[model samples]
Target: MSGLIGRLRGRGRPPFAALAAGLGLAALSLSACGGGDAPPANVVATGSAPSYYPADYAQVINASKGEGGTLTIYSNTDQENWAPIFHDFQKKYPWVKKISANNLDSDEVFQRVLSEQATSGSPADLLVSNAAQAWAEFAAKPNALMAYKSPELAKLPKFAQLLPNVYAMSVDPLSAVYNKTLIDQQPDTLQGLADLVAKDQGKYRDKITTRDVKGSFGFTVSHAFTSARPGSWAALQKILPLARPETSSGTQLEKITSGEYVAGFFISAAPAYPVAAKSGGLLKITFLKDGTVVLPRGVGIAAKAPHPATSKLFADFLMSQEGQRAVAEGGLTSYRGDVETRKDRHTYQELVSKVGESNVIFARYAEVPGAEVNAFVSRWNGLLGH
Candidate 1:
């Protein structure tokens, strides 16, 4: 993906830039054809009946009709992973001319949305982020998000909803991804991995991969690990010397697939599942038998959304049963218990049953204070000799 994007930008055909340029050229051509004096085109409005809405959901569906306007979303999730959800949404409401989804880093998305809000602007009708700290920061600001309680929240677990507006779109369980061709055998537990690394430290030097703890998502996962186990930092100290640190999971997966690294730890299952499935036995995921961390990706509406009702409808759709099924089909683990996909994959409920509730460590996103993050980063940098 990075290589493709780099090639596109190198060729002076960046996706967003090309889109804007094409729009400008179309207007210019219209004016050149003696249509400059003509009035603007009229938008055709559709009936308030959305195909996916329930009988009692008519009121909200009616409210979601934005008079043929477009809905824009700012998200950290990859566009491919959420493409099905967007396609279904468009099918339900054909009146919405466009649904612009921008994929950016979690920190970039947070900063851009906040800056726009401060300037009385709205670049996105909805925001989805993996960084919990960003969500907390946005919640601190007055009217940063428009609150709306979804009726579907009742069907979801309590942990899925952070507030009336903010909800978990997906919960990704962290696992160990290994290159089967490089490693003789995969570790069944985190302790087994630590022991293997410690025994053959020189053999695996710089051949293992893990997230850089200083990054937004990295801090969230690493802090949760340390908080869950008393000796996690000690284990990390013995392992970090033999591991390469990366900020992005995609890079880690690619490196592992290419045999640059034997294995990667604390990798999110949402993105890893799709990559591993496509690798034809080269990549494999293992949930640590000792315990594993589950990270929730958040979704919420912008306060000054251009299509506020449309944003709410999209959010509701994500939490619906059909949407949850689509999420699982897209290779993301759904939090809803009822969602089950092919290949005997596990839903949140199935995972709990298999791993045991006591073995699943849910990251306390809201309780992680700023001071703890600072201290963790400082220690991590010192340990890595950065």
Candidate 2:
């Protein structure tokens, strides 16, 4: 997909000569439409600052224009989810020639930044990830991130400000998914699911799925969900015995889709929502009625950012109304309440409305005590009979 987008940027062409004939008409259409050589006339360019913008916001834009180069980012999300954002950002800030957005694991995003900066310095200007533990660990290092407080910060929810530097890029709720055809009694909560399975362990034994809880994402969501309430561990005792643990959300969703697994809990909705959208009634998803864990993907500028001014501009742009709407268009849940609601996209406001404000558990950016984490993982493993 990144390669496809690169081709769209006119940086390169498709490798196969055989494809030229088929692509010729599309090329003609692109040329006819000016091929995005400039932003549309209606676009309020970044130079035209809004009233809410900081007095010095114009200086940042001018500085970025002076930099006049690619704004490199290391992110945990796929390029498909970033394409719309990059397109919209470029439209607003035309001087930014390109955005090199690389998709990597949440932990790897920090790893690359740390390892590179240790040597010749990283080219990455921005970093985005939802792995809470990795984030806490990274921020513990000296000069781990740039401590620029965005003017848009005041507009965001307090929890969005994960640290002095890091902030939430998107708020994604963990969802429970099932093969509706295979399970007639769909459960809305973990406790309910446990009760349903307990009625007939023969049918559900080894059929339920959840995260492995060793990896960063799995641990963050699992720990948040369980620690949110008193009875969660009790519910897990019933469910985990019959569950198979997987490392990736995509795998869990696939198994559920194929009926290899009857249901999966603690699955990231970033991937699940899109799959459920096109499942044609085979898949169904619901937030846990007891407690829904909302994981915030953190975004921060690198301390040694190659394009500091451009990174700052991009960070502020992400918190703007237009940028939030574009984020929703990219299939990410926007947290800002001002954005208009759509049936296809979920938002933090909608999650609160459905699950209630009190039941929404946010995975915090603070580090968990090492002893507590070790004990939790040990108990979790024991539940799996490991």
Q: In candidate 2, which residue ranges exceed 4 Å CA deviation?
A: 1-46
Q: Give the TM-score of candidate 1.
A: 0.82
On lDDT, the leading prediction is 2
Off by over 4 Å in 1: 1-56, 344-346
Candidate 2, residue 167: lDDT: 84
Steric collisions counted per model: 0, 0
Q: At residue 360, give the lDDT of candidate 2.
A: 94
lDDT for each residue of candidate 2 in 168-263, tens digit (9 for 90 to 100): 888888889999999969999888998998899889888999887766677777888777786788888988888988877888888899989999
For model 1, residues 49-107, the per-residue Cα lDDT tens digits are 33444587776667777445467887766555565565554555555556676666665
The candidate that achieves the highest TM-score relative to the unseen native structure: 2
Predict model 1's lDDT versus the native. Answer: 0.69
